[model samples]
Target: MPNERLRGAVSARELTTQRCAELLGVDPKTVERWITRDRVPHRAHRVAAADLLGVDETYLWPSVVDDLRTVSAGRAEMVEFYPSRSAVPLELWRSLIQQARESVDILVFAGLFLPELHDITQLGERARQGCRIRVLLADPNGAAVRRRGDEEGFGVGLAHRVLLSLRYYEPILAIPGVEVRLHDTTLYASIFRVDETMLVNTHVYGSTAAHNPVLHLRRVPGGRVVDHYLTSFDRVWTHAKRTSDINAVIAAFDGR
Candidate 1:
């Protein structure tokens, strides 16, 4: 029992639970149950309530089930998939990154597009504001990049991309609350995690990362995909060498 009465998203919308129930033609207790259980009403009811309450359905009834800190929000599945990583809107990325207060993680091989796409300065500010940012990059000289290149039909070309991308992220070393490391694991996916939500790009058998679709996953009760990837990231992170130690190699690649 997580003090259901006091957790009032309704207050933000200027409505009471009783009024919400009336708008949905449900009993006040049912609405209370929905709140207590951290669940949303039926689709039609939620739509009506959203219209009546003047909030987006997502705002009016967010995925309480996937809110990592909440207890027992009910059993539900809320996974979204994108056609490609580039297809994911920039606004979503900015929102997720800006809103993250606890932890942020990135796992990728040749993540050259990330620095080009998002503002690294904003990420540094987030680190300054107490967000723990952990980044795992592919060891540019290691076998993992070689394997990834062979698999992607590029044959070591991606190693250059990895080196170039590392240069873009190197300055973040001076930022507090951040760690950058290099791993040699055969990467199966490129992950961008903000707190409990993640955008995972699964590597295709013989395609470049840009051609692969991205899966947007939120942590939800009774589901383990998000947790599974989180565990994978943790394992890789533990085995990775800190960039401070790997800088010699990065320097060797410079002026090439």
Candidate 2:
């Protein structure tokens, strides 16, 4: 059977077999055989081709699961773990944001510490340099925010913090390639993605985010953890309100 997945991935990227061969340092016929004959490439080529096609190696070749399981690829994706979100170094956070070439995505209820740690204006410089920056905050007017506040014994304080965080993010909202959205969903984890590296803060009941454990994950071929979080981010991003709607909500809250 033909390897439709490989064929589709290459086609989706508009890469010809010859181009892929050139990049993979293989003969063009070999590339065609991998797709048409379902020939599994060597481990190195599998990794290289997957990275180039922007998909997991297993997605292209399901039978190549032995190496992933043997190496514990999921655990390998973890670069570090902090006892709590507060335990993550400020320098590490700064370095991640500063080094990001492609994207910076933040998903949180408030995440007020971000503005406190780094000047939010610096994100504009990143956007100018062609980094796509996305900030997803819990909508102050949403039920989830209120519920979170009550759960944390903060009452309306959490909502207020969200408003304040939005204020800090206000300037960057108008910048090209920088998007701010309001999500009302129950947040299980707060994800801070700097390209392929992510810091995932897992939420616990009745605990503030500062007290939550953070897993620092970098994407690895055949790993599923990072992709799971990325999919969650996309789902939330899809249904979230745009900047104009969030601004109106903030304005209304301020007026009252």
Looking at candidate 2, the ten consecutive residues that score lowest on lDDT are 62-71
**Each prediction's TM-score versus the true structure:** 0.67, 0.75
At residue 78, candidate 2 shows an lDDT of 95
Q: Which candidate leads the pack in TM-score?
A: 2
User: Per-residue CA lDDT of candidate 2, range 118-168, in tens?
Assistant: 999999899999999999999888899999999999998999999999989
List, residue by residue over 1-256, the lDDT tens digit for candidate 1: 4324324556666778887778679999887876787666665666576556544455555564454533333123336778887788888887987898989999999788888877776778889999999998888778888888898887768888887777777777789888888899988899999998999998888888887899887887435467668878999999998886446767665534
Instruction: Give the whole-model CA lDDT for all candidates, comma-separated.
Output: 0.76, 0.91
Count of backbone collisions in candidate 2: 0
- Candidate 1 — which residues are off by over 4 angstroms? 1-77, 245-247, 252-256
